[model samples]
Target chain A: VARPRIEQAQQHLDSLTKPPGSLGRLEEVAARIAAMHPEGKPQIRKRGVFLFAADHGVVVEQVSAYPQEVTAQMVLNFLQGGAAINVLARHAGAEVTVIDMGVNHNFDRQLPLLHKKITKGTGNLRRGPAMTREQAEAALTVGVELATQAQRDGIDLIGTGDMGIGNTTASAAILSVLSGHAPEAITGHGTGIDAATRRHKVAVIEDALRLHQLDPTDPIDVLAKVGGFEIAGIAGLILGAAAQALPVVIDGVVSIAAATVAYQLKPDVVDYLFASHNSTEPACRAGFQILGQEPLLDLQMRLGEGTGAILAMNLIEAAVKIYSEMATFDTAGVSRKQLP
Target chain B: VARPRIEQAQQHLDSLTKPPGSLGRLEEVAARIAAMHPEGKPQIRKRGVFLFAADHGVVVEQVSAYPQEVTAQMVLNFLQGGAAINVLARHAGAEVTVIDMGVNHNFDRQLPLLHKKITKGTGNLRRGPAMTREQAEAALTVGVELATQAQRDGIDLIGTGDMGIGNTTASAAILSVLSGHAPEAITGHGTGIDAATRRHKVAVIEDALRLHQLDPTDPIDVLAKVGGFEIAGIAGLILGAAAQALPVVIDGVVSIAAATVAYQLKPDVVDYLFASHNSTEPACRAGFQILGQEPLLDLQMRLGEGTGAILAMNLIEAAVKIYSEMATFDTAGVSRKQLP
Candidate 1:
């Protein structure tokens, strides 16, 4: 973030009507937007969310509660505008883009898919790496290119989303490696698994981390060893947004894990990112801790269709509006308190 | 709240596409709306918020950061649609009604004020009781009658807000009396007071509580002894809404103090309340703990012009819409997971 712009924003906010620092986090949000673009009034007039839909080979471990086909089905659901993200994005006045990163199914040739599939799906991480290092880099490049595309298309703010069944196992494995926490400690019942399935998922993640023995400092190695293709894509998106100086709102655990990888790659990405929710997933908290970012909201929502991103977009818009529109104490003729 | 409708609402929510209880507090919000209606659908199409602007003689004790004139000035700001509440209420699709419970200044007769001023302001609680028992009961009756009028005007939901200079001092006093906490423990800087002013505010509250020596269980006695008119009005609004089965969203610490008093008067009023934020005020948390309520959001907001209530109205509307409009698993043809 630009420190000069942030200081300017704070000074501006302190002069607004009502008490100094009274608007709380909303004031911080306005300052963040100002830091992102210091020259003129910053606004989120055009919003775009990239929903990276892929299949996780880890599903073969029976770690998730739902079938893998739900991933492709949800992608179609997105195109048909029937998913939660579509509803919430519309509510937030944002557009949704579905990127076919590594789904196992083929779509119609005419469908509006970003079509950057690195592979049909990632390899089963329990026995081997989820993907080749080259594939991970390619997925990350896809994210970078998509973010550039969004900015070129006049998208002011970007949001990260994921739609892949059993991807939580991959996310947990990545988090366990990065956060140095035991797999059981960072694991949660993703998509509402039963106790037995949750334990099995934990074991799968534990086994993957033990087998991979990847270096934590190298984000690409982590992504190739245990991360999903969509996760790498999300990381790429974060880097792309940071390079272009656009604010990106991150969704839940999977997205935060991606952001963790992105932050490791380019620490400046942290300045351009806004976290969405403290998801019910335990791993998400660990990932956020690693990134040193606090989520703007915590609704206990685990339905990660970028719903949290959309809800946060509303607040971001409000922050920008308040910063731009609210009359200052001088303009409103509101008297300041006399301190003793 | 209607128990039968709450049961039916849970049944309906279980049939949704997401995991059971995945939405967390949002589901509880939907359930509350269902219980309020207990019929085909519960919707808050017409939302109303009452902003009770009053003055407190306790300002003579140097207990507030802002001057007493701000109470009436903010009321005029509300009437002119130039305050935070106005912006937020428009964003939430809610209407605002400024009720002059006891503003020190008089407004133009044609300025659309709910003019029910109770003696221009309350007496200094440091010297004696804030108001007589008859005046406390009268102010509460005004709240009851206003709620009835709102329901008659087709307002589906109600929100509580306050605009008083030293109302937080009065609110802290009420909370200190009722929760058995020391004044220093409950008192916080209202409107961003300096350290010395905050300390003095706490001392004034302590002196008032000792002077009153009122009964904690008797809410009316507590209000008559230490509460401001707007606090009593909020309590009365909550009770009236509960009697009519309307869900009322509360703003912050002052509203929580009012809700605490209402909860004491009729414990079932808890069922009809939707808390807005986990205010930064320590007394607000104590008040919520007393009422067994959790706020829906925590934005660190301390501004008390119904801004929090308006933001909460947006979520309440979303909850109602999701409950009534979102497709169920059976309707959406989404398969449920087979649990072991």
Candidate 2:
């Protein structure tokens, strides 16, 4: 990150119409974006929300509230601009890209989507590895390619979204293996499951963690062992955004799992990342703690289709507008009033 | 508020292509707006951020970080569209209105603002009443008139902002008297004061509260004794918005004080009020708890220029857009395969 540019932006913000640092996190956002530019001016006009879709074999254990088929169905919903992500992305004027990473169902070849399924979803995670190491690598590679495609399309900012049934279980399992948090403590109601089902979900994650014994030191081992393909894809997207020096607003639980994967691989990539909101999913809190960045909003949103991310991207735009449009003390002819 | 309309909107939201209640507070916003309209559909396209500027006689006690002159200078900044409120309101596509209720500094007759100076600022609260009861009523009438003017101009949503140098001290006094919290407990650095100055500010408020012997049950007496004109103006705005059946997005410290006054006067107005963000001011937390309404955002923002409220208006717009534009499960051919 351009430290000098960030400092310059803060200096400029202090000279604007409000008290020093009174704009709070919005000012930090503007300063962070200022560092992204060469002239110390923040510019993030174009945005894209990448909605990765896949399925988890652990649905056989009823770990999720929705069925595995809902993943492909929601992918179709995204292609039709009918999902929650599409609504929010459109609100933010961000383009939506639906990537089918490893959905069990096959989408039509002409569905105006990227069909990159890896092994038709992974083995039932409660029994064995979710996917082989090579499959996980391929999923991450897919995310990187999509992010590269976003850059080629002149996207200045990118957001992460996900749609995969039984994925929260996969995410909680990943967080448990990596962060050493108990699965029962981190697991939550994915799509509003009952208490007994939640307890069962926690148990499934525990069994999967015990079965895999994934290496916490290696992000890839953890991802391949327990993470969903959509999760791995988001990890790839974060790394790709970092490589391209574009800011990425990460969404809810599954995306946080992906962020954890990306963060473990390269801690420095945190600069290019923005935690969108505190998801209701407990694993998201654990993931945020591991990633070490505060979210912009806390609306208790946990839909996980980049809805929170896109909403936050709008705030980023507002922050940048304030940075660019607000008159300085000299221009406004206001005194630089400060307390002694 | 129309409870049936709110329930109808919530039902509509559940039918959309996401899990029930997954959108969290955004869903609540949409439902609330839906209750405002005749039909169950939500609509809040027009927004106005009312910036009420005044001065405080308590500045003689050195309770604030800036000078009393800053009240009028910031008012001029608002007039010239150069203040933080101007920048943020422009970002939200909301209109900015500068109301000089009692700024002490005389703006020219031709300055495009509502110059309704009640007493050229209130008396020193540490020694005596902040204003006569009649003067407090006049300040509140100014807010009601502004809100009514907004309605005449087709603004469907309104926000409250404050600009008075020592108003936080006045606000702390009002909150302390009303909620029975100590001056030191709710007092904070208004415009970034030093520790000794903050300690002195608490002492000043304590002295003022003691000198007034204000009635806790009577909000008007509280306003007349300790509140600034801008605070009264915001209280009137909240009441006016409720009368017009328009939503009021309440801003930071002074606005919350105004809200507490409004809530004390007419508790049902809480339905029309949206706590925009959790203000960093400790008094604001007590204010929210007293009002019994949760803030939409918690960005640690303390700038009281309706910055947070305007930002939150953007989110409400997003929520309404989602309500209006998203496809339903039936429309999108997605099964409502929710957990039993």
Candidate 3:
């Protein structure tokens, strides 16, 4: 971040007609965006949602409510523009692209989606590693390459989302290993699971953690052990967006897992990342704690497909407009604080 | 609220592609909007923001940070489309109307604004009644009449915002009387007042509450004693929106104060109202507690001109689209949970 530009943005916002800092989070968001640009002006002209789809071997443990094949089905639903994320991204004027990282199914046709599958899915974490270290690195590299392509495509901002049947279990396992929190504490009902299934999901994550006592500093080792391909891809996108000075918005739990991996891999990556909303998922809160950031909206949304991120992009745009469009007190002839 | 449609909305939402209630408050908002319409479908085609501008005599007691004239100046700022509210409302595709409700100043010529001045301003509550019971009623009636006109104009949704230099002081006083909370707890720094001035503002509200000793049940009596004209107008517009079955979004502290009055006047009006965002003002929380409702956003915004409400309208529109646009599980060829 351009640290000095933050101070400059604050000074500019104070001169606006409204009370100093009375805009609250809106002002903070605007100033943060300003600090991102070289000219100290924040503008988001084009936005995109890079939704990565993959399959989780952990689904074999009966951790998720939906079937494993639902991941590919939802990807097709997204391609057809019949999903919640498509509707929301359209409302927010953002484009949606499905990045096929490692889903268990195949399109087997020329589809309007990125096909970069890594062997249909990762191995089940309960038995051993989810994927090899090389596979993890390849997924991450693909994500970085995709972000570079987006930058070339003139995208000003991008959001990360994930779709995998048991990805939340992988997210919980990652959070447990990184944050050293108990599985029960950071595991939640993913895609509407019953209480018994939630307990089982926690147990499944606990088993994974026990099977692979991952290193906190080795983000790649951790991703290779218990993380989904989509999780690694998300982390790579975060790193790539940070590398390119492009702002990235992190969505719900799966994205948070990716963010946790990215933050550990490169701590400075936090500067370019913004949390979209407070997801009801427990790992989301824990991951945000590790990032030391607050999510913007608190609507308790847990759906991932970059839906929450798209909703928050509207606020970020509004903040930029508030900073750039609103007149100063001098220009508007508004009175200043009396007896301040 | 058409209470049965809430269940119908739930049932219908569950059949969509995503998991049941995964959208969180978005689902609740869509359900509430669905319940409002007889067809059990939610759609927000035309949204408008009704902004009320007035003046408060409490500025004489040194309770506000800004001079009273800033209210009129900001209103003109809004009229010029250079205010934060104007920018945000335009972004959200919502139209804004300036309603001059006893703003202590006159345009004297025709302007593109509503002229519903009840008086020069409300009398200082520390000394006596802010306005007569008849004046408060008149302000509220004008608000209702405006809603009726909006209904004729095909506005399906409306939002309430207030602009008055010292309106937050009156709001704190009203909340103190109605919620039985002490002024020291509910009163806050309005419009960037210093710490010492905030303490003084609290003392001023405390003095007004003591001078009035208002009845909690008698909303009109309470408004007559301590509330500002804009607050009454906001309350009136809320009541009018409820009468017309039009959804209304409540903005910040001043709008909360008016909502407190209207909710007390007719408790059923909450069915038609949605708290936009949790304001930085302490009184807004107290008011929402009274209404037994939770706000949709938590951006910590305090800029009142319905800026928060306008930002939230984008989400509401997204929620309606999610409810009406997304494909069902059968249509999308997606598998449901294998077992409950």
Candidate 4:
């Protein structure tokens, strides 16, 4: 962050028609964006949401409400612009890109899909590590490559999303290892599972955590042992955006797990990332605590398809507009506050 | 609220690609809008924000940080599209209308103004009632009349905002009576007051509340005793919107004070109210508790110029689009969750 530009932005915010420091977080958002683009006008016109679609082998344990096939089907729905993500992205004036990372299904050749498959799917984590260390690294590499491509294609803002069934199990397991919280303490009913299914899911995650004995210090170890392929991809996206000095907004629990990994790798990446919301997932709250990034919105959304991320685009744009357009008290001939 | 249409909206939400209720409050918003329209499509194309500008004679008590004249100046700033509300309303695709309810200063005839002045300004509450019962009624009538005009002119949504110096003290006084909280517990550093000034502001509210001994059941008596002109206007706007069955998005503390009064008038008006964000004001939080309404956003914003209300228009529009668009499970051939 550029200190001079941030100071300048704060000065500008103070001079607005309203009382000084009255705009609250909106002013902070403006200051941060000003620091991001020191030239001052940090407009977010070309926004893109990278939807990483994959399937988790852990669903074989019946941990999720929906079937694994729903992941691939939703990917297709996203391509056809029939999903919640598609609706929200369109509303936010952002383009959506569906990345087929490891869906365990084939897509039509004519569809606008980014083929970055690390594998068909990872091994079931209830027994052992979900994927080898090499495969985890490869998935993260793909995310970085996709983010680089977006930045090269004139995308100013990137939003991270996932479409993997039973991925919340993986996210919870990873968080349990990283935060040292019990599986039941961090687990939530992903996709609205029943009581028995939730208990079963918790038992599966506890088994996975014990079986892998993952290293808390090493995020890659955590990802290979418990995280899903799309989670690794999202981690890479955050790292790539940070390296390129681009802002990346992350969605829900899955995205938070990825952000945790990215933050572990490079603490500076936290500056480049924006948490879209504090999801209903109990583990997501733990992940945010570990990262110390407050979400901009909290609608209790648990659909991790960049829906929350895209909704925040409006707020980000409003902050930029207020920073760039609103006249100062001096310019507008408005009187300033009288201090006693 | 239409039951059949709300049921239909819920069915549509369930049939979407994501899990049922994964959209959370967004789904609830869609159902409410569906109930409002009931015929199927609920659109919010035309949005209007009514900024009621006025002045408070209580500023003579030195309870505010800014001079009272800034109220009229901000009214001009709003008209010139140079205020924070103007910037945010433009960003949210909403039109801004500045109504001169009781600003102490005069405006140029060339300027576009509602010119609905009830009085020059309210009497200092520390001395006596802010306004006569008749003036309080008239100011509220202005709000209803303005809302009716907006609805007739094709505004599908109404957002209420207020700009009046020392209004926060008045708001705290109103809430202190309604919520039965002590003055210090409800008062805050409105517009960034110093430590001594904040103490003085609380003392002023305490005196006003004790002097009036206002009846909580009679909202009109409370407003007449301590509320500013713009606050009454906003109360009237909420009543008018409810009478017309129009959705009214309300801004921060000042707006909530108005809402408290309006709710007291007609409890059914709560059905039409959408809280934009929870303000940082301690009294605003208590006001929301009294109204039993949870805000959609909480940005810690203290600038009460309909900025938060305008920002909420984006979320409302997104909900409508998601309800009206997005292929259902049957239409898109997606599978639903299997409940045990």
- Native-contact fraction for each model? 0.37, 0.72, 0.85, 0.80
lDDT of 1 by residue, B1-340 (tens): 6687788898887786676877767788988898777657887779999999888989988887788887887787788776777767766668899999988997887898899988799999999989999989999999998888888989988999999999999999999988988989989988888888889888898888888887998989999989899998988999898888788999999999999999988999888888888878889889988988888889898998777887777777767766776666666666677654
Cα RMSDs, all models: 1.8, 1.6, 1.2, 1.4
Clashing pairs in 2: none
**Who is ahead in DockQ, 2 or 4?**
4
DockQ of 2: 0.68
For all candidates in order, the CA lDDT equals 0.86, 0.87, 0.89, 0.88
lDDT of 4 by residue, A96-166 (tens): 98888898987777788998888888789998788999999999999898888988999988999999998
Model 4 misplaced regions, further than 4 Å: A2-5, B2-8
A90-155: candidate 1 lDDT, tens digit per residue: 656789999999999888868887888888899999989999999999999999998888889999
Give one digit per residue, the lDDT tens place, for model 3 in A118-158. Answer: 87998999999999999999999988998899899999889
Model 2 chain B is weakest, by summed lDDT over 10 consecutive residues, at B36-45
Scanning candidate 3 chain A in windows of ten residues, the lowest lDDT window is A33-42
Give candidate 3 regions above 4 Å deviation.
none
lDDT of 2 by residue, B41-141 (tens): 66676888888888889999987777777788888888888877887787677888888888898689999998788879889999999999999998888
Restricting to chain A, the TM-score for each candidate equals: 0.98, 0.97, 0.98, 0.97
Chain B TM-score list for all models: 0.98, 0.98, 0.98, 0.97
TM-score of chain B of 3: 0.98
